[model samples]
Target chain A: MKVRVEVMLKDGVLDPQGEAVRHALGTMGFAGVESVRQGKLIEMDVAEGTTDAEVKAMCERLLANTVIESYRIEM
Target chain B: MKVRVEVMLKDGVLDPQGEAVRHALGTMGFAGVESVRQGKLIEMDVAEGTTDAEVKAMCERLLANTVIESYRIEM
Candidate 1:
């Protein structure tokens, strides 16, 4: 099975990387870019019988930093 | 308007970061993780009137390295 994990910074967390991108876009003359937030997308190929709980454990254990990021899993 | 851009390495390109993650997962005792690929998700808040062409231009010129990465845009 294929599992996709989308990990994003929790709201209110400072995202220096996203801010940098937004600034770069402004300087590149792409006006009207009000804000930007950057996140990660991890695609995984697992054994057919891999359970959702196992995948969730993967995120909790490594894929995401739960203190500052939230992740969603899609199968 | 909100725009989402997903940028991923082109197939056949080396992804050392993904490999490292996979290795880490293996060592952490998460078996059945056959393969992993990591990508970026960029979310932007743009002016309401921003057109798709402009957004595509952003991806082509700044968001993704066309030589090694492909990007998908969502609204």
Candidate 2:
């Protein structure tokens, strides 16, 4: 099975990297870039029998920092 | 308008970060992880009239390293 995990910073969290990109865009003359938030996309190939629970466990254990980020799983 | 840019290393390109994550998962006892690829997701809030061409330009010029990475834009 193929699973995709998107891990993003929770609302209200500061994202320096995103800010940097936004600043760079402004300097490059791409105006009207109101906001930017950067996140991670992890695509995994797992054994056929791997359950969604196991994938969620992986996210909880290592893929995402639960305190500051939230993850969405797509199968 | 909201735009999402997904930047991923092209196939045949080595992804050291993904390899490290796989190794870590193995150490953490999550078996059956056949393969893993890590990528970037950048979300942007841009002006209502921003054109797709402009966004593509952003990806080509700065958001993605076209030599080794490919990017997808979603609006």
Worst 10 residues of 1 chain A by lDDT: A43-52
Model 1 Cα lDDT, one tens digit per residue, A7-75: 999999999999999999999999999999999999999989999999999999999999999999999
Give model 2's TM-score versus the native structure.
0.99
Off by over 4 Å in 2: none
Task: For residue B32, give model 1's deviation from the true position in Å.
Answer: 1.0
Docking class of 2: high
Q: Please write out the lDDT profile of model 1 over residues B1-75, one tens digit for every residue.
A: 999999999999989999999999999998989889999999999999999999999999999999999999998
lDDT of 1: 0.95
Per-model TM-score on C-alpha atoms: 0.98, 0.99
> Which pairs of residues have clashing backbones in candidate 1?
none
lDDT of 2 at B18: 96
